[model samples]
Target: MQSSSSLFPVALISAERRGDLSEDVYRLKPGNSPDGTVELAVTRLGLAEVAESRGVPVILLHGSFSNRRFWYSPKGLGLGAYLARQGFDVWIPEMRGHGLSRRNRDYAKNRVADYARYDLPAIAAFVREQSGQIPHWIGHSLGGTTLAAALGGQYLGAPAVASVALFGCQVSRTYWPLKIPPVEWGGRFILKRFAQLSGARLKRGPEDEPIGLALESMRWHGLFGRFGDGERDWWKGLAEVDVPLLAVSAAGDRQDPDWACRKLLEQVGSEHRQYLCLGRRQGFSGDFGHVEMLVSKAAQVEVWPLVERWLKDPLTPVTGAQPEVLAVG
Candidate 1:
């Protein structure tokens, strides 16, 4: 295979050995988008030394107001660490303006469409170039929604994705007030007043989110909303996606409810697809919330194993025969 790094200038920003984990951080400059705005930073994580060369490659995408640290903490107490120890090649990328990624020229205007069309393909190319494999993508919240947009738009096709697993991702959730023109316009007016939202102040997460994200979301969920980019209809395009899929929804997540999540999953054309809802009714110890479903200690034990199983084999039928599937259901 040709080296993708040669096609795009990718700088090795840093490399560190932390006990059992070898962290290789890289920065790729994909230059400017179609709008003539340059993206300064697109950073990716590679945990390779301890990774099993024979194991499948996996990329973990953090939610909004987050970075690669959501998958791997400094203390090595994250899902990325757990996967690396179990022999998977884990690649985590911090979107532009998040974590080590510096704010770009279009930082204030950055939206999910930009991420799906530019950032993700860049990350996928670099990861494939390095690992020589199509990676399984795992994303949370906005990260998952971006993945959906990429697949739905056919921006990142089967050549780039081996499979996808979405956590707390949905597009069907109705914002009734936003459906009202006056209300929608009013909300947009207020959001445009601010350049960005403070993650620390809002207690959303560690990093801030651009107002552009909020703006685009409002447009999508508003009255004349449809999930897609300026080029294609993402929501409608989802029916064409043929890759394997694992859609996980947290029942306690009022943010992105189970029904909506399942609706997104049902829209996908993939024959190899599974849906798992985490709640007490499903026999899970408790109803997992948006973040807690993945970040909490309970997820470490219950959810991680199911993810592993899905990665290994996504076609397994959920005949309600398996304990893990039942619990995850």
Candidate 2:
């Protein structure tokens, strides 16, 4: 069933053996989205070494204005690399127009809706085809939001996702200006003029983000807005998702506060869901920012192990005190 959607052939774009880290990059030109002209460039990072015991497949989705490097640095020193060393079949996917994934016909109009409905399912199908198992998903920031949208919209369902770990993600972030009709329309008017937002220009990250994402977000936060596309109500649909969920938040993340992240977790209907907050108040070494919570050295020491533990046994809540932060199981 997973292989059915292998509509576009995956081309092995690059294969390089870098020390202990084996990298095989693939590119999938998956036709197009509902908006006829919007083709997709979905790139995957597959670790080549045959695992000692065929570990579980894990897919890491990078956030907005970012690329596959968010999970695995070029020097083989990121969470994805660490997981590969630990015997996990790690697959890092660069979303449309990010990294090796080139822009499509409707590049300027690309939105999260397209990502949730088309790109993710295609990635899942391809991963399931190769791994022969339901893959665990780890998404950060906007990546997590897209994951939630996919789950909530029922575009990606059980037997496709073994478990999900969301880091620094929430849809409830209030944009005060968008609450007003004039401001909302005005902002959209201004944003639509740009084809894409440059990461280098913004100094936010390495990759550029399509203006469609900005427009989509504006619609979501606009007055009388809701969290879903025209077809589905993702906010309402979230209650139907019943998988092992781990929503992680950082106290110092002004971008996505713990309360909002927890709110997203709370809406899920998962019987086995855990909320982990990283902060000094929670006994963590220090308060973590949005990006640092996953990429920083402290995260590698403290949070990465916790993430591994969760992926290994998501149903088993992390109980008792630990040297790390306290998690609401």
Candidate 3:
């Protein structure tokens, strides 16, 4: 096995020699579409180093209002770099309307459903075409929801997702506290008026910065305790996912409460499932917030080990003793 830091030098040197932007660098590039083109930005890491080691490929999906850079920041967590050092190919995608993925000059419409139906599926296809294998799927928040939707038969010719790991996603309508009131009671008129005034547009981040986008998105979705209930049917698709699931939750995450994650496991309908609660024993004083789990400094030492152990375990029936858990909080 090679050290994580060893994976980058060669690639960096090669890129410099060839005048090519290294994978560890971030860039906003144009994406092809039947109608025109879209500017899709992404942060590539552990390309030459991990690929040289013949590691398993992993694709990371960012939450709403976030871009790929979320995984590269010091506070953004070290999962991508750590996994790359662990010999896994990692690709972080910026979904449309967020980060670097923006619509063509002529078409600026941003639809949430379109992200599920188009952006995610295209990313999956791109991964398969590039790696010739189905990469492991990991997501958080809206990203997790979108991935679940893709696996639930929402997309055409969906790739075979090997395994799935989700953080902060819910299914039941009960998990969502918002509901439409009776139209006869004038609720519909109020909603219509509100929509008109607000416009059916995707919320923009406070700035073009990745973390800013993340914060803004969380705020818009009421994940920070601002909005009412989320869409109940959004999680119904999880029932169709048959892959092994590693569902992690933050005890302090007020956005997607721990109860929602627990319910997701109980009703996910997957035979192979594991649930992890972070900061439970500490009275929720840990740094494992909704987004911090993937971006915080402590995440590498605290969270990645569990993920690695699960991924490295054999897919076959149990044959050995279970691994012991390490208390991080």
Model 3 C-alpha lDDT per residue in residues 1-329, reported as the tens digit of each score: 33112212111111211111126433332233443454444445564523344567677887655666555543333677677667777778776545555544433333344456556666666556556788788888767766666665446222557777787775432312222223222432333333111112344232122232232233333323321114424345556556777777777777777777777666566667777677747332373778766666566656776677666652432221322222211
Q: Rank by TM-score, highest first.
A: 2, 1, 3
Best candidate per lDDT, number?
2
Q: Pick the candidate with the highest TM-score.
A: 2
Error of 1 at 298 (Å): 0.6
Mind giving the per-residue lDDT tens digits that candidate 2 earns over 1-329? 12224556667766777767677677665654655443334333434566334578899999999988888887888899888887788888888788877777788888889999998998888888877889999999999999999999999888799999999999998988889999998888899889999999999998999999999999999888989999999999999998889999999999999999999998998888888888988878999999999999999988888888887898887543654433443
Q: Give the TM-score of candidate 2.
A: 0.93
Location of the lowest summed lDDT over 10 successive residues in candidate 2: 37-46
**Candidate 1 vs 3: which has more TM-score:** 1
Give me the overall lDDT of model 2.
0.84
TM-score list, all predictions: 0.92, 0.93, 0.67
lDDT of 1 by residue, 1-329 (tens): 33237647767777777667778777777763664444334333335464435467889999999988888889887888787777778888888789887787768899999999888887888788888889999999999999999999888889999989999999999989999999999999989999899999999899999999999999998899889867799998999999988899998999999999999999999878888898887868899999988988988987887788777776674433323342121
In model 3, what are the clashing residue pairs, if there are any? 75-295, 76-295, 77-295, 177-229, 178-229
Candidate with more favorable, higher lDDT: 2 or 3? 2
